[model samples]
Target: MSRFPLFAMAVLGLGLVFLYVPTLLVIATSFNESRLAGVWTGFSLRWYGELLNDRQFLNATANSLIVAGLSATAATALGTCAGLVLARHGRFRGRVLFLGLLATPLVLPEVIIGLSMLLVFVAAEQTLGWPAGRGIGTIVVAHATLAMTYIAYIVQARLTGLSRECEEAASDLGASPLRVLTAITLPMIAPAMGAGWLLAFVLSLDDLVIASFTSGPQSTTLPMVIFSAVRLGVSPKINALASVLVVMSAVCLGLAAWLQARRGGKVLPE
Candidate 1:
């Protein structure tokens, strides 16, 4: 401890406090006896019970889970394909343009993405007379689009650091392109794929802005419900919901760390 610089230690302490203090407060408030958030009369579990019984909340949670699960799967598939193509297919036509398009969503504002998606959906409805209206399907599509960018980047980074010897060896043995991908490339990047899928799931579950724009009356997600509750005022119910979300986020983070560590172990020479 004494070997560390004082300024660095102070900054680290401040940063930890900045990040976790509010989270700690929210968790604590969820157990409070009072109905209001941040006002603790005593300890209580009433809010958690109430949360379990709230029909709207439960519906929103179900919708969010469905969207997150389906969207994450879709994003992982699309992103993994994108990453594989970019990593393995050397110097294709419009490679730079394709990569740039893939990366655009990562840096683009959520508002812009949401608005553009909304317009596209509206146009499709008007022109094709399909989709009927925005709902779970639209939300899933929007989230998948947002999540795929992150997945593509992660898979790309993983592939970049990977040795291509296995793939080359397989090709030399007369394995077809599809066989090499399925048998060698995918197995090599399995950890990265798992990480990317979890990342996509978490991102989709936590989204508010894009869901707000793309979701319709039938498809209110958990974040939207939480946001509405906050506008009215923070209650113990909100605190409880937030606490559950925190637990979920922590689990996802732990799983990601485990996957990364496992990948590192496999990649390192013994």
Candidate 2:
């Protein structure tokens, strides 16, 4: 058993190094004086300054933030509703079909989802004269679709772990259905909702494949910009941008974890 634990720890350490070493290298090289990413002559913050001044990168970052914020919010709302209905209410007609459809985006290839959404946009624009054309709006919609699945999964898991007795007690105490849901159900599941939102935000921010198909010239997201830059070759500037994104994601995920832990401590019986 001691040997097994040692082996497991070694395996875990190896896994962490594999995942994080490349990122650490990128961050380190971003400060290297040499333009070539591999060779480091000396450290400098010039690339960071350049990135801050680059109008195109700035615009892409802003667009990404807007899309992520909107998409995550929308996905969280829709998913929370879907999860509550699925968990609290008994199985309704077409429940399995509805769930399958909702989760299809989660398992489906990004290329396929992007192509399908593009086709739908084209059809809608030509037939209904809605959407006008593909741009930021379409990208947000695509992101929301995928993000909703993640949110739904998280919320559903939390709901499964929750006791229905709390809601019953609230109702028994003369609380209306809406009041019980607002006061009991929503509060109980808020941590899951928060976790779902953060996941959605990261997913939207990191997305490139779907955004590529949906975005127009005016709405290039940060990931798209980084991808285009990387295709030219690895640059310190790209490394700097990637490092910034990684830090932001880590911070967001950490906050989500803290919130979840706090909620769990409060909710679980002593």
Candidate 3:
């Protein structure tokens, strides 16, 4: 049992293949000359050329990027605050209600969240005359609301594992609470914050239902466009787009990790 577990290795290999085989195939099919998936002709980049030229796809891509960036930033900010409060504070009045609000999005279905947000926006606009109409702003708010829970969970878990000795030592050294937070607390948790931001970005970029509910005319995100296209028929162009997204996600994560490591202050205190 202490030696190599042949059966476990076999299972792990199978699991990896099962998970990544389809992704590899999709990437390969994106370069295929054929429009269909099963029939792969010689390698070609026709679909990539077409996808870049597609006006609707370009517009949707822009919209998706804008929403993802704004939502991820907002979600991370709110979530970090929520996480700090939950993790640092002991029991307090209304703490249960506060926790419930933070956790609600994680438990509830996306469809329900989208619908509820839509309703809230509608009511607010009718009464308060803010937001005038649904569009990028509404989508950003919806995504932020739906995504902040995930960021909160990440930050909370990170904070839970972190040693508070650093902060305590800093306080004893005459640093104010805010100084300790800015210098010691924030640096230790920077990696988690970055990861949470990336996760939120991916969620907002990949979301379709919530975005659909909140999106107004001319505000369609990439997923919405892709969904609409898929309804008509699957094309190699979609595969091309998927490959692009996969590559872009990988690049972003890798770049963030590299930057974090380069900064060199995020390590946990011994």
Better of 2 and 3 by lDDT: 2
For candidate 2, list the clashing residue pairs, or say none.
none
Task: Write the residue-wise lDDT of candidate 2 on 39-59 in tens digits.
Answer: 779989989999999999999
Locate the minimum summed-lDDT window of 10 residues in model 2.
261-270
Candidate 3 stretches greater than 4 Å from native: 1-12, 253-270
Q: How are the candidates ranked when ordered by TM-score, highest leading?
A: 1, 2, 3
Q: List the residue pairs that clash in candidate 3.
A: none
The positional error of residue 102 in candidate 2, measured at the CA in angstroms, is 2.0
Candidate number with the higher lDDT (1 or 3): 1
For residue 40, model 3's alpha carbon misses the true position, in angstroms, by: 2.3
Which residue pairs come into collision in candidate 1?
none
Model 1: per-residue lDDT, tens digit, 8-98?
8999999999999999999898999887654569988988999999999999999999999999999999989987887777998998998
In model 1, the Cα lDDT at residue 146 comes to 84
Q: Hey, what RMSD does candidate 1 come out at? A: 3.3
Per-residue alpha-carbon lDDT of candidate 3 for residues 1-270, written as tens digits (9 for 90 to 100): 835688889889999999999989989999999877788789999999999899999999999999999999999999888879878999999998998988888788889988999999999999999889999999999889877887777677678878899999999999999999999998888887887788788888889999999999989999998899889987899989988888877776675556446545232212
